[model samples]
Target: MAENPVKIEKKKKKKGLSYLWIFLIGVPIGVILAVLDVDMGFLDVYSLSDFVAIFILFYVGVFLTINLHELGHLLFGKLLGYQFLMFRAGIFSIQKENGKLRFSIIKNVGYGGLCAMIPDEDATMKEYAVYSLGGIIMNLLTGGLFLYLSAFMEPGSIWKMAAILTGGASILLGIVNGFPFFSMNQPTDGMMFFSILRNSPMAERFYESSLLTKKLSSGIRPRDLDLLKDFENIGDMHDLTKAFYLYFQEMDKGNRDSAEEYLLDVEKNLHKVPPYSLPAYYYELLFFALLSGNLEKAKVYHEKAGKILMKDQDINGLRVKAYYAYIMEKDAEKARTLAQKGLAMRDHYPFKGQALYEEELLKELLQKIETERQGQ
Candidate 1:
């Protein structure tokens, strides 16, 4: 009943964390104590100013840990041909200059350093890992470099402390990413590790890719609409063709109004999708209309969908006859002519064996139509 509804409610991502990083608050409070105890320190021009300096330092420390962790991922990705997209290190945004993204190194009391990374998708899978391992390797190496430099440097105190903080942060990022946990998706932990014990790191990747492809090819099941609603809250168009067919299936079962709404939405949302997906989408639409007894509307939609299909999309004689005879109400001679032409194309294409019922029904209907015309 509604005019052209668009069901573009792509699924959204959720925060899977148990809680906010509130447990880290203690580290900042502790740092305030350390800064306050320093005798004759430049941090305090006054007593209140001393507290402010420590608090500021505390905030800076926490900020650094998060950034460094993300940075590990970011730099690793780029050095390995990954293009960095965005970083979410919390306190500060990293700036990119001349193909190099900058970093902010801050040492914290209790927590480790933080960093962010964004990777480009253009590189091969092997190249992707080179980026993935960058953060962990760099942090470990930097900490060691600092230890050696401390022997020759006068500020052994600052470099030593920096190494301790940086080292911890680096190890934390590496372990967390390499842990082989369900949540981690980094190449080393997620894709690469699975490749190891299973002896096929590309196994999960291949399976996921295959599943998603098959899902699109088969189209969405009618019962899957409730599940698909959440998908719209996300980006969109990962499964438009299947979802649209599912909606059409809903219409097929006598829910005309709901089907119409879904079909329109799917059609509009498909504007951004590939043109290759259109033929199947249109076939489903025409099928739904025929089942719903909307012959006239089916004819209109059929033409729209039909104009987009090449002769290769379908080679089914029954479908061609049914489309012409039932949808367009064309004469039997013309309908049979088109059906025979379609059947000729089927010489190289077999009947799939699954459409046995539809094939029989189509033959019977064509014979009946021919008989009726003869009697007249």
Candidate 2:
């Protein structure tokens, strides 16, 4: 399938920083407060200890607010017959697998919290909108409640300050997430809500991807599932969701040439890619480059993705590192070690089908490394 000519949207650039309004407004006010000796009647901090306490409480409140936002999605999603797949806050995660709940610690960069749920097969657009906007609604409701409480509390009290700070944080979170924009390369709740409401093509792609992910989690391999037939003629190949599915579809079907073409296309139009998805994209490109013995291209992609590769503990990240160690660094022992470690993680990986595929890749890399060593 041939992609249409590139016509990028300039509005995406403007949308990138729309969520920074809180920081933009707060910084000037903070500077003004520091320049003046004015005692803000209700929010005055008297001692260094009080300031320290407020700071600590404010961070705690922010952490709690993140969890509350995710909880809102959970509660509202449940109301609409959506089944919870996972809930994650910071490094702690709880996921449902084989009808059982399991807790673990996992690293998910570029996100503060995540609430993943699968909608019912017969879910309507209204249900999706409600689920998507649930977190924002919770943030606003909690923010308002906290702000009201702070208004009634004693002036200059630590509790009052805590309430005010928490309220501000919650409101900020709500407003930032409620405004239609992309964060970490993924659309925000407001963006999803509006897209679903309008029944945009993006929304259709998003829902389709979610259904595909659910199938993956249920143990369906990419090679076994059919690709979206209509997506073959998609004009905007730069659309991440479309690119993602097509790339995987080709790769899983053992069409390396076609898969690499998709990767190279994404490389050329990277500005359209989400920031959070960059590392994974780079890793895949690096993998293909190494597999095809393109040392220079491998070097470029490895350099671009190096920071995340060094620290990302995901199964695929580990597999890529193992591949890189063998192909680029010529470290057979290190490659074997990383590949073994990745194999050990297969049982714990969230998506069983992907985990199984990664396991195969790691084993293949290990075998190749051994073959080369024996030849030497």
Instruction: Give per-model TM-scores.
Output: 0.33, 0.71
- The reply for model 1, stretches above 4 Å from the true place, is 1-62, 91-122, 146-163, 184-203, 206-376
RMSD of each: 16.7, 6.8
Candidate 2, clashing residue pairs? none
Q: What tens-digit string does per-residue lDDT give for candidate 1 at 179-225?
A: 45433122334445445446563444423332333332233333332
Q: 1-376, model 2: which lDDT tens digit per residue?
A: 5543432343544554554565665886699788996667644445889888989999889988998999999999999987787798877878675346868765565467878887766777668888888898899999999999999998888889899889988988888788887655667789888998888877776677777766676677777766754644333422555566567777877888887777666666665564435677888888888899998999998888866577656678898889888888988899999999898878766666778778888988888877888998
Q: Candidate 2 — which residues are off by over 4 angstroms? A: 1-67, 74-127, 179-186, 197-200, 228-238, 303-308, 311-314, 373-376
Superpose all Cα atoms of candidate 2 onto the true structure and report the RMSD in Å to 1 decimal: 6.8
Worst-scoring 10-residue span by lDDT in model 1: 7-16
Worst 10 residues of 2 by lDDT: 229-238
Q: RMSD in Å for candidate 1, one decimal?
A: 16.7
